[model samples]
Target: MTLHQQIKAASLAALQALYPEQAFELDQIAVNQTKPEFTGHYTVVLFPFVKTLRCKPNELGEKLGDYLLAHTSLFSAHQTVSGFLNLSIKDQVFTDLLLHNFNNPNFGKAAPKSKKVMLEYSSPNTNKPLHFGHLRNIFLGYATANILKNDGQEVIKANLVNDRGIHICKSMIAWQDYGNGATPSSTGIKGDHLVGDYYVRFNNEYKKQIAALVSQGMDATQAEKEAPIMQATQAMLRDWEKGDENVRQLWKMMNDWVYEGFNNTYARLGVDFDKYYFESNTYLLGKQLVESGLANGILYQKEDHSVWVDLSDEGLDQKLLLRGDGTSVYMTQDLGTAKLKYDDYGIDQSIYVIADEQNYHMQVLQIILKKLGEPCWKGIYHLSYGMVELPSGRMKSREGTVVDADDMMDEMIVLAKEQTEAAGKTEGFSDAELQDLYEMIGMGALKFYLLRVEPKKKMIFDPKESIDLHGFTATFIQYAHARICSILRRENLPIMPDSSHFQGFVASEKLTDAEGKLLLSLEQFPEVLKAAANEYSPAIVCNYAFGLAQLFNSFYDNHPIAKAATDEKKNLRLMLIVMTAQVLRQGMNLLGIRLPEKM
Candidate 1:
């Protein structure tokens, strides 16, 4: 149990003991970190018991505080302020915590959990390359997976590739019409980029065709439907569904190019999937489910022969499952994929890391599955996040205005190189080491900046602000870790110092305000990790890491580890900094950020 949990448990026992006739639960006790201006490590509210016990707030706080000090060694001192009982934790609590876990690598991680989770993210379409918008989704999902895994859940990172549909056909058709049969090798462009160019090309031509039809006096909607490009795209879609060999070959070739490009990007991003589900293979998967639904009268067919489910009773409109031509819709494929995931992995939770725009769609998906009596419906979790926009505006893929992920990464590295050089911290490093450091700093800045905000809030990406060393970015945390390492090296101390070095220390050893605050922050790492896992938010972890780094910096400035006034003081400080570095490393690793030994 965490310190907060332990405190609550202890307070409950005290409350129950004090009032034998009145029943009290753990939830009735509210424990929070003491305000910075307060003189305690944690504060307990006394208002809940005030009314029931017919006692004043401060009176009740005194009763509870007296009970705690008399019955337990948890608190060294207690003070009543207003209606709150602020308790200072015993110095031995922090001393033992530091001595036992300072060098433990898995200090904050939990043991194995019974539940398994399949977290699906980065469901990128083959039609275009991943853009800046996709970065948030990718980082959130990846970091959440790591957090969950560290929290002891069996996590399967899954990627469902949207590698089919008219969008894919659009690129193929464009490649055939406009290209002189140029391949990625021939054009010296990344395969995904090459395919993405055609996707944009198709849109450009599609707009022109629409404009020409409108100029000839056709209604805009009719012109949109009757444009030659649209007609050809529709035909190609039908042919592909009907198993035309030529169309299938072209589809495979283009999707292959996109996959190769996607793999490279995923590698550079340091994310991997345990399994990959392709839309092409699973498009027709829901047809059987639809048949069963129709036979059971749960789903209805339109006059045009398209199958649909009426969700009006569930506060939603009718949802199409299959088209009149018997081809599956996006919803249809999603239904099948949901079942496929459960049948394959028996996951207790199926988390979909999709954007908030698809909130209704995800809702309908779960409802439809539940209506169909599918077991996977209960496990459906939509981790809906907001879109990422630039300072100017949102990006449009069809307009060829989206910021490509590769280009963004390249730019971040360039920024890192410039900042590192400007800081003049590149001494004593070879060319290879400098390159690796640049990549680490650049990628760390990108991931941390994107993840520092709550997932549900839309954010604007500012590259310059993200790499600032003194800001709440990964660069700041990384530099702090490096500073700790430098201190340890200069003092000739082992990275994982022997706990025996502190054997001469006693429980009554006085801790400076900075040392006490740093120890308190370090002790909360596990609790923070647990919160991150439960909330499915890496932002929590980011905040914790930043705070811990800040606390360490304050401790370093206020105390001297190598030249302490006494050997005992010096040993205590050494252990504190070593543990800080270890905790920082573990916490940042959970966010997929690397900490360098030197800046």
Candidate 2:
């Protein structure tokens, strides 16, 4: 159990013994970290006990404090103020905490869980290259998976590529009509980039076609329907869905180009998937489920033969499942994918990491699945996150104006190089080493800044502020880890010292307040990790890493680590920072950010 948990249990037992007639539960025992001005490591609120027992708060505090001191060896002393009773941890406990976990890697990770979970993210469309918005989805999804894994859940990370749809057909039709037959290899453009260019071309040409019809006195909406490009795109989708050999062949070719490009980008982003579900393979998936729903009166068919489910009872509109032409909609495909995932893994939970604009869509998805009697419906979870925007404004994929993921990464590296050089910390390095360091710093900056924000809230990406090394950015934490390594190296001390070296040390030597504070901060690591996992938010871990670094830096300024007044104090200080670095590395890794030994 964690330190807070231990104290809480003891405090609860005290309350039960003191008030035999009054019923009590653990919830009545409220424990929190003592305020900085307080003289203890933890505090128990006496107000709850006083209010329940109808006794004076001060009286309850003293009685409970004395009872706890007599019952456990955890606390050294207790002080009471108003309804708050602060308790200090024994000095030997701090030393034991440091010695046991200082070098034990993966110290904060939980025991393996039996229940499995599947987290879906990065559902990118084959028609376009990944953009800034995709980065947020990918990072949030990837980090959340790692957090769950750290918490001991058997996490299955999956990706559903929208490889076949009207959107994919748009790029295909444009390439067929406008291109004098160009390929990614022939034209020196990345595959997804090449396909995305045609997606834009399809939009531009379709708009002109709509305008021409309007000039001939057709209604704008009618013109949009009559546009030849739109007609051809629709035909392409239908043909591909019907398994037309030529159309399917073309679709496969273009999507292959996009997939190759996507692989390169994913590698640079340091995100991966255990399984990839393609729309081409899963688009026809939910049709069988729709048939079953119709047989059971859960759904109805329109006069035009389109299938739909009425969810008005659940306060939602009737949602279309299949069109008149018998082609399945996005919802149908999603239903099939959800089922396929469950059949494959039998996961206890399924999380979909998607944009918040589709909140209503996800709500309908879950409701309809339950109504349709899918067993996995109960496990469906939508981890909806808001969209990402630029400092200037939002991006439009159709206009080819989005900040491409590759471009953003390149810009971050260039900025990293400039920032690192400006800091004048480029003393020792080879060309290859410098390149690797820049990638680490650059990617770290990108992931840290993005993951730092709560996923549900929208954020504006500020390139300059994100790359700056001195603040809450990933670069700041990376430098802190490197700083500790530098200290050990410069002093010629064993960077990874043997735990036995500190065994004979005297815990009664009296730690400076700064040393105690640092130890206290380190002690919270396990709980911080657990809290982050429970909340399914990387922001929790991100802030903890930054705070630890902040605390260590403050302690560093006050204490002499390599050259303390006494060898005993110096050894303690060295071990504290080393433990601090171990935690920062493990925590940041959960957020998909790497901390370097040198920066």
Candidate 3:
């Protein structure tokens, strides 16, 4: 148990030992960190027990504090401040905790729980390259997956590629008509980028066709509906659905190009998926499930011969499942994919990393699944995150207004290089080595900036400030880790000692206040990981890592480590610094960030 938990358990035990017939769970006990003005490690809330014990707040608190000091070995002394009983813990508790984990790299990580979970993120479309919004989704999903894995949960990272639809047909149509047998190699552009160019080309050409029809005396709206490009795209979708050999070959060839580009981006972003689910394969699986729903009379058919489910009883409108022409909608594919994933992995939960715009869609989907008597419906969780807006406003794919992911990362690396070189910290480095460091710092800054905020809130990303050496940036945390390394190098101390040979901290006659404060924060790492896992928020780890780094900096500033009053004090300071770096590395690892040994 942690020190906070230990004190809480003991306080509950003390209260019951003092007053019989009183029942209290540990969670009901409110324990907070003692204020700096108070000479204690933690404080207990005593006001709630005033009426339950039939005693004044001060009187009952004093009685409880006296009992805790005398009977509990957790604390050495206690004092009542404004009805809150503050308890000072024994220093040896902190010392023992630090010694056990000072050199252990996985100190705060949990043991395997043996339960399996499936996380799906970065559901990119094959029609376009990744953009800024995708970067947010990718970072959030990757960080959360790593957090769960570090917490000892078996996680299967999956990606559902939207490789089919009218959108894909538009790009294919544009490529077929406008291209002079061009490929990624022929044009020397990325596969996804080349495909995306045709997608935009389709929009521009469609608009031209619409204006010409309007000038020719056709209704604007009707012209849009009657355009030849629109007709050809629809025909292509139908042909593809019917397994036309030419269309199928074209679809496979184009999607392969997009996947190659996507894999490169994922590699640079440090994200990987165990399985890839294609819309082409899973779109038809749910037809049977929808048929079962229809047979059970849970779903109804409209006069137009379309299929839908009436969720008005659940305060939702009827949702379309399949069209009158026997073509499946996106919802049908989702159902099939959900069942496919469950049957393949036997996962306890499936988290879909989607945007906040689809909130209503996901809710309706879960209800439909539940009404269909599917057990996996309960395991469906939509990790809905907000969009990434620029300083100007929202972006449009058809307008080509979104920031490309590759372009953004390149800009960040440039900024990282500028800032690092201006700092004049590097003494010697080869060109390749410097470039690698630039990428690490650059990508670390981007990931940390994006993941630092809560996933539900839309954030305006500023690339310039993200690489700042000060402030709450990952660069600051990296500098802290690097500082520790520099210190170790100066002292000629081994960074990782043999676990069996970890010499216990010297017998310091007395521990300083700074050392105690640092240890208290170090002890909270495991708790932070568990809380982050429960909440499914990477923001939790970001907050914890920044705070720990700040605390270590404060300790470094106030204490003299290289030359101390005694050898024992020096030993304690060294071990404390080592443990601080260990915790920082573990916490940042879960956030998909790397710490450079030198800045």
Per-residue lDDT over 1-599 for candidate 2, one digit per residue giving the tens place of the 0 to 100 score: 88989989999888888888988889878999999887999999988767668999888889989988998899889989998999999988898898788877868889997979999999899999999899999999999999999999999899999888889899999999988889988999999999999999999999999999999999999999989899988998879877999999999999999999999999999999999998788878899999999989989999999999998898778899999988788899888888999999999999999999999888888898899888999998899887887787777898766888998899889888888899886779888888888998898888887788888999877644545556998888888899999998887756576777676765457888888888888888889999988888999999999998998888888788989888788778888888998899899988888887887
Q: Which ten residues in a row have the lowest lDDT in candidate 3?
A: 497-506
For 99-122, candidate 1 gives per-residue lDDT tens digits of 888889989999998989999999
Cα shift from native, residue 587, model 3 (Å): 0.7
- In order of appearance, the predictions have TM-scores of 0.97, 0.97, 0.97
In the range 431-543, model 3's lDDT, one tens digit per residue, is 88889889988999889988989999997765434445467988878888888877776767866544443355455466778888888889889988889998899999999
TM-score between candidate 3 and the true structure: 0.97
Worst 10-residue stretch by lDDT in candidate 1?
A: 461-470
Model 3 steric clash pairs: none
- For model 3 the local lDDT of residue 143 reads 90
